[model samples]
Target: MIKKIKKLKKIRLHREGTDTLVYGFIVIAAIALLLWRFIDSKVPFWCFTAIMGTVYCIVINFFRCPIRFFPEEDTTGLVVAPADGRVVVIEEVDEDVYFHERRIMVSIFMSLFNVHANWFPVDGKVKTVAHHDGNFHKAWLPKASEENEHADVVITTPEGTDILCRQIAGAVARRIVTYAKQGEDCYIDEHLGFIKFGSRVDVYLPLGTEICIKMGQLTTGNGTIIAKLK
Candidate 1:
């Protein structure tokens, strides 16, 4: 049981955006230089530079991974939000792929402005880690949960409850990076994975779990308590 581990409050840029940031800056700089050096009008150069600069800053914000910790001491029956986003769904549905039973599915849809880093939602041992290739759909849609390219990570909590966290790819999201490994113990505050660009994360829990979030509510990954298990 991971009772009370270390806490880090500082926010840092995620390394996954390193290459993209570097290349984006270079290309933007090159274009700005050409506009300044070859074009006579200063208006176009300044306008283009400003627009690209704002876009780059937005991209940087997308990759910002904050070091957050679950504040409570006891983790039993606690389930945290796996990603920072607005809750798009909260309902009971039949989970066919794994549980095959009726379960509460809470889905969070991350937009381009939200953080893309994901965190483990509970103290548990990973039961399974699998990725499926599928179509890229708009993440907020219900069908995107299973139809989109995604990674499934099922963790068995210390209390013997199995929790499934699915990372689904949005139409703009092309990559899904999962860090959970089967049979390995995972705890809250540890990164579960990162989704490049915008995406969605769905957490499937057994029916009767007390949900702490409502639809359209904003959630902070690793910080927002999503539910309480039985």
Candidate 2:
């Protein structure tokens, strides 16, 4: 039991290698500014310290990685939340890219304060992964899902149901990192990707599937059950 708990608690740094480079540059620049302020004494020490401190706090929080536990029983029909955010959209829409049919689109808009780590919504094998280059529109906008830069990952369950999840880049979010590879088997609640800064994620479910969440509701990634497959 102890070992099982330990394994569940294991955490991973999403985009750690890239993040390290960013952190190193930010810290070094801040320190250099502080040193310069100290030597010159032209600007008030407190003001400089406060400004740099706030910047570091926000940057650190943006890259935070939290542990997520999977459901204890089999997750065949369970659809978990893929990202931490508030439900922004819940409607039936025509999905042209992958499905070429109508699907129920559930979108979660993430703020800077929310965890940016993404998780797989169900147990499945990745069918395809595609990335698009586009404008940086605000993620909460309905058009962002189709217009903004994003990555789409389609997963097929053992029962042969197709689920499509997309990671979208917001005005402040410039990067979308996806870990999904075609033909790779993925588990529910497992790490899927990360979006730098604030963004959103869209999940396309087949019509007639039970929707468990409502509009404007907040969701905790991997912890909140979004829906159930038929």
Which candidate gets the maximum lDDT versus the true structure?
A: 1
Question: How many residue pairs clash in all the candidates, one count each?
Answer: 0, 0
- Every candidate's lDDT: 0.94, 0.86
Candidate 1 accuracy as TM-score: 0.97
User: lDDT per residue, candidate 2, 16-116, as tens digits?
Assistant: 43565477667767776777766766455556667766866666676778887864566768899999999999999999988999999999999998879
Give stretches of model 1 more than 4 Å off.
none
Q: Across residues 1-230, which tens digit of lDDT does each residue of candidate 1 receive?
A: 64666676989999899999999999999999999999999999999989999999999999998998788888789999999999999999999888899999999999999999999998989999999999998999989998899999999998899999999999999999999999999989899999999999999999999999898899999989999998
lDDT of 2 at 126: 97
- Look at candidate 1 and give me any clashing residue pairs: none
